[model samples]
Target chain A: MRTAVKKQYKVAVLAGDGIGPEVMAEAEKVLQVVADKFQFGLTLTPALVGGAAIDASGEPLPAATLALCQQSDAILFGSVGGPKWTGLAPDKQPERGSLLPLRKTFDLFCNLRPGQIYPAFAELSPLHPRVSSQGMDVLCVRELTGGIYFGEKGRTDTDAFDTQRYSVAEIERIARVAFDAASKRSNKVTSIDKANVLQTSILWRETVERVAKDYPGVTLEHMYIDNAAMQLIRSPQQFDVLLCDNLFGDILSDEIAAIAGSLGLLPSASLNGNGFGLYEPAGGSAPDIAGKGIANPIAQILSAALMLRYSFGEEDAARAIEQAVQQCLAQHIVTRDINPNSTYGTAAVGAAIVATLRQENR
Target chain B: MRTAVKKQYKVAVLAGDGIGPEVMAEAEKVLQVVADKFQFGLTLTPALVGGAAIDASGEPLPAATLALCQQSDAILFGSVGGPKWTGLAPDKQPERGSLLPLRKTFDLFCNLRPGQIYPAFAELSPLHPRVSSQGMDVLCVRELTGGIYFGEKGRTDTDAFDTQRYSVAEIERIARVAFDAASKRSNKVTSIDKANVLQTSILWRETVERVAKDYPGVTLEHMYIDNAAMQLIRSPQQFDVLLCDNLFGDILSDEIAAIAGSLGLLPSASLNGNGFGLYEPAGGSAPDIAGKGIANPIAQILSAALMLRYSFGEEDAARAIEQAVQQCLAQHIVTRDINPNSTYGTAAVGAAIVATLRQENR
Candidate 1:
């Protein structure tokens, strides 16, 4: 019998603009440390994206960058779009060029947002004790690549219109994703929609019901989007996997992050047909705090870990990085965002995680 | 000089099935006491609706009820919909006949929901001390009758769609309502939408901007629905009038109620083209708790107060009823929902509020 050789994991890193570069640098450092500790053969290929690419090569996302992404096992994306690139036409905007292209290219169907409130950072949550005490940890699996966001748009002399459309295939595919995710976690999935009002939602609910037959092991429930919004605040712990459309997911995911405590510490992954996923921080590019050297890097670093597990199949490496992050927080080594009294800079906080990882390896 | 004849306010009261009858009775008692105290000439006309009508006349909302509502100065509606009537088809469902038709007949364009935290009920909030200390109060002004809810809907063999349609005129009208409301209350309005992704939202924002030019005194801000949802939980009091489309409003208003402490305490008003408005509790008919006298009547009573102010223009009567309810709560004479320890039944709570109004008059 011939010994099988494991494939090397290739990651396409898009460090876009502003704090993106800073955070990406820290995430890369953490990944390298994890790679060494776990003996995983990892290769990171840098690609120009967003305003940085537009500045250097006259395009926000060059054809070459897409080629690099196609070859890579996973893509780790930093934030895109800044005021400097806003003057560009709608299609050429940094966000449209890089973010939309990547999603479309890979047909990234599912957006997995894990809103976990770390035990160490529970105090940072703004929710009342009763609301937050239950430990708000939920994975929102949103159908990203379809729905109204990708619908047809046009303008006439009298009126402009955008179609809010969905297909049964789209709903079915996303429903399966949510059901599969629910099976892995708490075995409960709350499908959110406006079925009572929208024909699209009624179809969505029916399709979800049909797909749910394939996953009898997982519990399924339906909630109107409005009630879901209230329930998120009233008792977040009651939910497990929240499956919703792209638009509702975008709003609800952010809401979930706010409830979890801090937007600064959440990571997300967008995956599609090719097993290639784009991992990024749930937080936006904070232009106000861009050059302060004080932006929290945990979300970015964790995105790198997600890339390791989902894109590269390096579960051990991902677990090690996650543990190091937890250890750093446990030991009271945190950034200014989570611990205001802390005097640590972003680099210092990133270094602490690296140091913890080194010690754990020893 | 001839003295102007004082207008006599006429109210059409629809006391639907279950605890609707109980709450509506209390609301009527409170209204009568307020009318007497304020020396406002008022007449209350009872109308049959919902399951009660289904039993008596085999119709959910009889023609006589519609005529009575059309003649009244305002409609004071108790909760509708119950399991007993769920077997009916979509058109005959109590919600469609009593609720939808009422909205259509009134042409109620604006639905105003004020979520206030009563000091007596602060202990009932699930938030921790630090989070709930400031208390949360929000008034969500939702455009009641438009957006995707009323848009054209159809399904093909493979696809389904709902038009997220809004005209500039519609958006402008709703925006003016929000600005006017904000001027009266906290002088701040946060317009919520998905402007970044939806063309409908883009139009919505543009129309609001144009309308806002007229209301310079009111502070204006625009937030994506996602961020607004987060902000609602993070710092709810930061909002005054949260203006959004019918769809977003429906969801956000419910969320606002949840954050304010209890769904049982929120009231809403839906107004139409003819200046005729229907006032109702935000809480739906709880079929499970239908026959029990435990359903909170505060929301229902407050809805009647809204009916007086908005429809009848009986501001003094409205204020009197509001003050009585507040005094009752301040004195801890609340219902079972707000005060489980209290021995007060639905009728007793209503009587207490009526007594409070009479005492204030004395």
Candidate 2:
């Protein structure tokens, strides 16, 4: 029997703007620890995005960056968009230039946002003790590249318009992603929309129903967006996997992340059928906190863990990183975002997680 | 001096399907008491709706019912739609007939939903003790009539489309309603939308900003719907009034209601510029527990209070009814929904509230 050579996974890292560089540095540190512990052959390639790229070469996402992303096994993105580059026109906007291009280029159809409450930092949650005790953990599987967000728009003399469009093929493909995700978790997927009011939502529901037959093992439920919003607040734990269109997904996912306590700590991954995935923190670039040495790094570190599991097929590496994060929390080692009294900077928090990983490995 | 004659408000009562009848009856009882106490005249006109109407009159909302709603001073609508009526065509659906028509007919531009955690029923909430401590109370001022829900829709052979259209006028009018509402509350309004992604949302933000200048005393903040959703779950009390477009309003109002713990105790009022308003329970008709006589009547009773305040301008009566509700909860006179072991039926809950009001008056 011939021994096969294991391939080295390549990651394209886009440290966009503001705290993006700081957080991305922490993620890289965590990734290094994971690679060393798991003995996985990995190569990290850094690329420019957002205002950084705009400053360097008058383009937010240069051709070279795109080429690197295409060739990489996975992409780890830091936060994008800030007031500094917002004055630019629609096409020149850093967010559109970088994030949208990646989404469109990779055809990243499914965006996975897992809102999990870390037990140690549960005190930081603003929810009433009774509400938070129920364990607020939700996985929102948003249709990334379709629906109203990508629709055409125009403005007239007296009226303005934006198309809210969807196709059966689009809905079916996203529904399949949701069903697959539901199978891995609690096996329940709540498909949310405004089916009662919108034609697109009706089509969405119809397509979901049709596609649901293929995933007989997963339980499916339909809820209007309004009711879904209320249920999210009332009993978040009742939901396992939430499947929704692009616009509603954007709103609901953010809301779920907010409820979990800190936006600074939530990471997300957008993936496609080709195994090409883009992992990033759910938060945006806080320009005010830029270079302040106080921005949270946990979200980026967690994104690296997601990158390992999703792109590199290193489940053990992912688990090890996650366990190290939990241990850090258990030891009350956190950043200023969750605990202001403690004077830990971004690098300190990243160092803590890395130390925890090393200790656990030993 | 000429004595001003008190206006006799005409209220169209649509007691449709399941526990709808039970809750409607209780609301009617409370409203009658309010009329007597306030020395105002209220004529309750009954109308047919839902499956019951479809069965007996062959129409969910007959033309006569629409005419009655239009003629009435206000509408006190009970819940509609049930599994038994699911077979009906989309147009003939009970919810479409009763709910949508009522909204369209009146052009109810403003939806007012107040979510307050009852201190007496704090134990009933699933939230942990710390999360519910400060008490969650929010007034959701939702644009009821426009945005994506009411936009144009059609389907082609290859795709389906809906218009997510808004004009400056539409956004401005709704923004004014929110500002006016905030003036009466905690002087803060959070306008929610996806401004980063949608053109309609950007217009909505601009309109809200313009409207804010007119109400200099009221504090205004802009939040993306996603973040708003999270904030509602984490720190609901921090929000005083939430103003958003129709679609977002529908979702956020429901979410806010959920955080308050009991949908069975929430009520909403839809209003237009003409001073004509429609009051209804936020909770849907529970067909499953319909005839069991175990349905919670507090929400219905609260709807009656809203009817008194918004329709009849009997603010004192509204306050009395609200006080009575608080007294009922404080005295542990809740229905089975909040207190499962309690033997109180719909009638008993209504009677307790009425009795509390009478005692308070004495």
Candidate 3:
């Protein structure tokens, strides 16, 4: 008999504020079950962050926590900020102090937000039944660090101006992220830009087209930003992955989230070039539901799955976790957030997902 | 006995290409009925434009047509461009040649697009029945001459840039248009911008606030572009007049049009500082449906109604024409576009609206 060595991975776990810790506890339970079933070795290092860190060290992101993250493979982030930290200076606020600085330190540039309408939860969508019945599963790959938001801006006595600048290197990197993501999902990527009028968009389209050549199996198409906005609402089933610059992404991603039904079920990941990422729920910490034991844990659990797939390249483990979640939702073993009348609590929901994961064979 | 002199108005009618002629004839019939009922003197001068002008004089906007437009109080434009004109040079293409030049020559800086969903046609909306049941009526007031679209743009060896520049005068003028439009409708205006990130948007918000003081009866609110996009889908009934710069408007207006059911029911207006305006349908000229007599004429008829309200300031006549079209749609006397299986043609739909207008006591 030959001795087998399991693949080992390290992640910095920062369950930030309010309901963060409660939901994160459930996520941990589910993650542990997934690791055991997939035969992977996991090392989760817990750290203080957000309001909790502010109380301990008078800083939202303590130096010790930053050092821990620097040594880890990825960061599994929970929802941050609460009323307790509202009095702090804007820069010292939990969100701005932690996430923004972490992104800068790691050079995290690509943001992936997956908006889906599961057939079981299709009724949650705001679209007419006729449209929502077709279902939607769109992944928005947005360039996070560049574009007009980070470009030069100034104001004269009577006029104000902002520049939207993009280099070929910047466009190429983001395009690759989108294409790579599409190859993993539906094999189709729609690059969105305003090519007809803006010089930057013209360059963006050209660069994206060049990058598409590398991913031979992925189908690539181009869409104007305005048309993309309408198409998302008119026919969301037609899209699999949407590649966009910062400004357009900021608008379209929110639209995608809105049409995806409940915000509590959405997960987001901001990744650096080296595959390291900060994964979190695309929602805020609800202080009111902190210890209620009924907060939904699906988003937090999904974030862990994203960390597994993007940072660890454990696609099997990630898909298993996702399918487990779907099974729980299908069985109505959900928290109050997803179903107000449901009797299941956060722990029960996570336990249900874990039980489903254990039964699903690879 | 004192003789009452009817207010005389001269309009240059440019029924351009494809289904433009057929639709314009129906629009003219409705306009005539409304004018007779409202007691107004009207002079409509027929002129060639788009592919028609290109064939007649090898120019999409012939010099004679420009002269005719300059002599009139307003321009009633039908759809422009078709396959026949696609062979022309990029600049000489029907739409690029005619509308672009006309907008530039007249300095038409304000664009108004009203998107509405009547209770009878509520089933046409893409929103869930629970959300669309409330109905929607939003007017998008867009600044056409400023913003990133027309701002300075250039490309370097590795980078490309586009500037989003706005002056106090530019913001103030568009702000006034929204406020004035709100005063006539719901007495509410929602100005959309990205003030948190862009200097131009900050100036835009400040200028709009200062302009709000001029209209005390109208309520004003500011929203980020991203949030505006989401809110439009989540709760469209909350909005009335949407004030936006060129880029944001381009996206939101298309979104509004998409949610309003059919493109054949939407109308647009472009106005200069002097009140001279150009009114047209938002949909394109359906070359395939041309000369079939089955094309929808509601949009063209509504364009004539917009001309009466905005340029001629014949509010009563405009309201009567709008109500007549609604009554016709409610009765299901619509063309193939609105109801494909219906046997009604362009002439029948226009005649129904004309009869409805004559019967309605305005």
Candidate 4:
């Protein structure tokens, strides 16, 4: 009899600084549980980044680490930058030195942030129960590399200017990501822009509308940026996927995160055209809580879930991990961030999630 | 003893269309009560505008109406536009033809929208009790004629662009409005911009900081626009005055209004350099409820109060009107939009507020 091998994925893991290594350990453990249950091969290569890399090699991102990332299928990033690296030149700081370079080098043009107010924890939301009770699951798909953020900017003695520019191809790709994500969820998308005022928005609207034809199953809706900001707070449950340009996305994503309540539970992904991605928690590395075994691991574990869903195409495994996290949260087996009354530590919460996933597999 | 002439204000009242006339009538009634209590001479001139002007003279903004507004100290505007004017061309539409022309003609570069969630009606807020119970009072001071909205824009076959340009003069004028408003309220102003990446934002921040020197009593804080959006939802009460360029203001003002709950209770002001202004409700002409007596008149009443405060510099009169409205809301003497169970109509609500004002004076 011939020996059979399970399919494998190599992910470069950058456990950057502070509580990163600790939370990442929990996410890795959860990934191991899912990989075993789903019968898939998983190889996670750990590499130094941020303050850790700086301490070891006098740089935030080591050449060896970048080479390793280049060889991997995807990057699993923990949070970066802490007070320890704040003494360095602004550009030499961990976040600026490491993450910016990685994103630029990889040409990561799309950013997807998943913001959700779990019904079990709806009380955490800033919105009233009438609105929060329905819960909100909005994925903000933002075009990262284009728009005013990366456009031509100049200043004179008397005035200053920043250009918001978008190409048809740029809008189309981000729209596809939104439609794809929407198709997997509620099959609806709300494309936000100021079409009545800006020429870029007019082009964005036209391109997004054209992209809708390709995804026949997914419905598309257009909303002005101002109205979208209001609607997100007034009725967040009405939105499934929100597509935005760089500047608008930067605003709305933070707004969504605010309404979602706990930053510890949000995960983000940045990707390129080739489907290669870097996944991480939207929350920062809490230097204050580092080495205390009390940091929330849900964001990291969810980032791993996103990695499985987007990078590896392991939908079943991804959902299983998501359900496990939800179950753990619903059961009140969460870290202090989610519930101050809960005495659970990072390892305990991770174990509870793993146990839930294993129980579901059986 | 010689008879003294009271300080008089010339106001052009443009009750445009639909419920505009009815709401304007109630607002005028409230204004009359305040004028009598405060002992100020008030000269009110009636003028045609919007659909009413179009019906009378085949133009949304009649030349006679413009001349009347120019001659007055301020314009007391009722809501404009209705389904009746939908057949007109986009440029000839009631809203575009009237308000845009008026704003442009007067060089109304500053827009002040006051969004507040009264403590009595906290339940109407989209925010949780923990957030809304404290009540929110944020004045959004926006640069009306600068930034991306009025910037150069164009489209090509492959791409499109919008230039967000800001001059020192533009930023200074808007910042003055914010600082002056803050000096009247909490003496704190949060300037919103994207200074990290955009050159225009850098100029905006620099200009605002320079302007702050003139108002040493007022404290100044700078926040990135994205963080401002998040902060607005997270802790709206922490804000007193929010200063923004055109685009940021457009988005934040709507968000503020949404969180404030009842749009029928909000008021707005657009002013030029000379203290001349156009005061209006931050809502529409509700054609469906035009002839019905059920239309809420608080917004229009509040607009009159803003006119007294900004245009005529009658701060005491303004505060009196505001207090009367608040008393009516606290007593549940409101229209259907605010309280469905309340039986008060437009005229009745106006009468109740006037009664409250008269009672206070007695």
- Candidate 1 stretches with Cα past 4 Å from truth are A1-4, A81-93, A155-160, A287-293, A355-362, B1-4, B127-131, B287-293
Residue-level lDDT tens digits of model 3 in A1-362: 98799998888999999889998998888888888988898889999999999999989899999999999999999988888889989889999999999999999999999999888888788888889999999999999999999999999868999999999999999999999999999999999999999999999988998999999999999999999989998999999999999999999999999898888889999999999999999988999889899889999999999899888999999999999988888888888777788999988988888889888864
True contacts kept of each: 0.78, 0.77, 0.90, 0.98
TM-score of chain A of 1: 0.91
Tens digits of per-residue lDDT, candidate 1, A51-168, equal: 8899999998899999999888889988887888888998898888888878888899989898976777777777666566677779898988777777886544334566779999
Candidate 4 docks with a DockQ of: 0.94
Q: After superposition, how far is residue B77 of candidate 3 from its true place, in Å?
A: 0.8
Give the candidate order by descending lDDT.
4, 3, 2, 1
lDDT of 2 by residue, B6-115 (tens): 76889999888889899899889888888887778889999998888898888988988889988999988889888988988887989887777777778888899998
The digit string of per-residue lDDT tens for model 4 on B232-291 reads 898999999999999999999999999999999999999998899999999999999998
Using DockQ as the measure, the top candidate is 4
lDDT of all the models against the reference? Answer: 0.83, 0.84, 0.92, 0.93
On lDDT, the stronger of 1 and 2 is: 2
Better of 2 and 4 by lDDT: 4
> What's model 2's TM-score?
0.88
DockQ of model 1, rounded to 2 decimals: 0.68
Worst 10 residues of 3 chain A by lDDT: A353-362
Q: RMSDs, each prediction?
A: 2.7, 3.5, 1.2, 1.1
* Per-residue alpha-carbon lDDT of candidate 3 for residues B78-108, written as tens digits (9 for 90 to 100): 9889888788898899999999999999999
Model 2 / residue A161 / CA error / Å: 2.0
User: Candidate 4: where are CA atoms >4 Å away?
Assistant: A1-5, B1-4
Error of 3 at B27 (Å): 1.2
Better of 2 and 4 by DockQ: 4
